[model samples]
Target: MSLTLSKKASEVKPSSTLAITAKANELKAKGIDVVGFGAGEPDFNTPDNINQAAIKAINEGFTKYTPASGIEELKKAVCKKFKEFNHIEYNTNQVVISNGGKHSLTNIFTAILNPLDEVIIPAPYWLSYPEIVRLSNGVPVFIKGGKEQGYKVSAKQIEEACTDKTKALVLNTPNNPTGMVYLREELEAIAEVVIRKDIYVVADEMYENLIYGDKEHVSIASLNDEIYKRTITCSGVAKSYAMTGWRIGYTGSSVEIAKLMGSVQSHQTSNPNSIAQKATVEALLGNQDTIATMKEEFNKRREYMYDRVCNMPLLHTLEPEGAFYQFIDVSEVLEKEYKGSKIQTTEKLGAILIEDFNVAVIPCADFGFENHIRLSYAISIEKIKKGLDRIEDFLNQLK
Candidate 1:
């Protein structure tokens, strides 16, 4: 007998970055020197102090189940985090912890969405936003933002995407794939629309501490008390503290919304990892000097990689103000053929890069942009240079 998947399950697409990562691993297994730029994660290991906290938790026999919404200790830490960095206020009852930033977002959407609800997603967004919305039986409205506007989808575009059916909008500042960090004014403008429409705002501040330059990220929750009341502000220790594998993320918002997410998380995943929760306390409360150092390193590498890619043949790059990726435009190379393959799209460019140059980058089609590739600068300066050199050599010979 044949089995069928549920319509909800069938609606989701595989993660595009993971596809490139899988091929990179395949080539690596075959003894190829594949340099994967497809990773959306930081290359740095979790800080030693955070690791020790986890060890301490385990040794102290603190391995039992935590509350569905997270332990009071960790929830308190999350509350402290918003107070420290964002200057917003929250209580333990208003926060829920999940496996990661994505998991937190999933909980938020699953708890609120009814079938066919509309979700507005600015394009060149994280790969999972549209899929998550669709999986929740909601319709995704895409607002395309290319290199023309700092890759930022404007408030006018967002206003057009809204309708009575619009239930929520996903905002990923220091965004994945494109690294477009929305400024305070930009977020306030969007917040105005959301407040007037009385729609929920899902704020994904996963890359909260990765901002470079003179830029500052202001939470939409801070725009006004009403926005704060309606916004589900999600953040994780993953990007900011380099604790990606720890699998602990959290959100702060209205008590009602938090209660709903807690209910969803209770049955779905139960509590988050217990040891990770203890470790996350240290990560959130510990000295953030390491974050500054990491950002400095990132800034240096970002500038270096930007210059190197700009000098590369057939590559057009935009300077991303935050996050570690350089979304290079490769539309000029379309229609060019190599090794019996006509490079007609970003997908072709990706497949060829993995197969030939052993360099893996996520194609823009995943992020709803068809003419670009996302390259992460989270690796070492030397590695970034090496990968760019290899990419340049391959593209130069693409004729």
Candidate 2:
């Protein structure tokens, strides 16, 4: 028989967001002035205090491997942060520190999912959610939340999708792509469903610190003791502290599940870099100022991008109350043509923008939305202005 790859590996969809970002980087490497709106990380540098912690660790020769899950000190720091900020209590044994938030999520799926088990995910989700779940041998079930609803799915929608095989529900507040934060009432309603169904809740709070205006971040687990017992909260320093390169992420869960995840990680990647773990300890305890600065900058960029996109002809967008993206409905231009090429979908539309106008945007087809696209305001305001100008010009050029 001919050699073949694993069915799961073969079936995984490539990340559309990364593909566009890679193309933009490739053009930039060739000295092209490509304005990019696809980056998911902050443009700011990692705070000096956190970097100094890593440097000190290296000087002290703290670079060796720690326990597979993570060092106890860092885990304890994470516990303290969770307890204080999230109002969720956690013992050190209930925490697992992984290489990054993405890795932490993969480990979680692997630990909790069995073959053909179902995970309920809302549409316009982060591109990796379904792929990660399917890679772990689980099935992904999606419920659509329309734009008028702020792309937030309801408890009734979640309840209707539940089945005997349902194992978990993936919830991301200040959600990716859409950038909408679920209100306390909205989360309580979802918590009620999770309680009634007795299914696990996988809460990705990676953007917890980047909320704008009066929108507050709430931990669903903090709603009650029963839900806290069943929730696995994943977060990292990547978004909040401009430490994406540090690769430190963690989960707070029940001790039993945390132990299993640690066991799985032991064979997968062994442990996160010891130096980075030490740096993260400083990130948690060292300072509170860097985060405020970054939030202020991000809020300014968010407002600028929001106003520009909203005023563009044929484009409609939701005001992102949190996170750094504007999800735009571009259905008006799908039926138009440019340079004799008919644009029938957001994928084709995105390709043309990158190829011709030197602008890069993430088409939301991979995000489970066919008529929309996502643009991140993580770049400088100058770049944001230039990119929006190019986008408007490109659309106007379309016939």
Candidate 3:
């Protein structure tokens, strides 16, 4: 008899973003001059204050396990951050700290979803939402927010997509891939629908502190009492503090849901890194000036990348309002020929670029868009210019 693996695990797709980044690194190791735009993290080093806190923790012998959920200090800091930043009140017990934003999401779905439940996710999403829901034994129902809608879904569309099995909806503002933000009016409308439908909201606000321009980052949970009760607001120190390697993400939710997530995490992974937790406390409550500095730099790169992409023939992108990605509409380029071969999909285009043009890009098929690609502007201006130049050269060659 042949041995069998878990069918559920076997069906899962590896993250394309990570795959492309890995491929680029592999080529670079071979001394190839690859201009990569596949990174999802800031190129900046972690702040000195945060790093000092971690060193202090180690010096103080604070490496032992605290609690399954988290230490008291970090939880209080998370609650304080929620109150001060998100304008949402949460007690320490109502907050849970996990390994990262992804872990927090996994915990949310595991705690909330039963078998066969449905999670409504906006299309052109982070590419992990559906997989997480499926791994939790839930269904992922997509609602596409087209280019016409600024890559954002309306409350009416969400309501239309709902059914009795609909358990929750994932709302990612200052969203990934497209980098568009939801206004207060839009959140209010969506909150009304969420209240009417009696569904949970998984609010992923990892990029909250990274928002730019006049747009404010409004947490949907902070909108009203009803939505607050239903929301599992998730965030972390990864994007804002340049602490991706620290692996500290947290969530603010109701006491019952928080307890459930904590219980699940107690068995699954015991606790997040103790030193990282100490560092995250500093990240949340320490000097916040680094965030503003980072945001300013990102805004400049965003403008430069947007202008360059807009000028490139057969390619166009919405000026990213927040986050660090520019979602390019490459459908026109896909319809054209590249070196006498039909460039049918963004995947093919990506391969041609990496193999021939020495550039790495993330095709958006895994992001629920077949004719688009996502380019992250989280690197330096020099690298961004170089990569964009290579991309333009490729576009110019399309027949």
Models, CA RMSD each: 1.4, 1.1, 0.8
**How far is 338's C-alpha from truth in model 3 (Å)?**
1.0
Q: Cα deviation in Å at residue 282, candidate 3? A: 0.6
What lDDT does model 1 reach?
Answer: 0.87
Candidate 3 residue runs with Cα over 4 Å from true position: none
Candidate order by TM-score, decreasing, is 3, 2, 1
Mind giving the per-residue lDDT tens digits that candidate 3 earns over 313-377? 99978888989999999989989998898999888898998989888999999998879999999
Cα-based RMSD of candidate 2: 1.1
| Candidate 3 RMSD to the correct structure | 0.8
Taking the tens digit of each residue's C-alpha lDDT, what string does model 2 give over 9-34?
Answer: 88888777888989999999999999
Clashes of each: 0, 0, 0
lDDT of 1 by residue, 223-267 (tens): 789899889999998888888888999999889989999998999
Model 2, total clashes: 0
Error of 1 at 372 (Å): 0.8
True-structure Cα RMSD, model 1: 1.4
TM-score of 1: 0.97
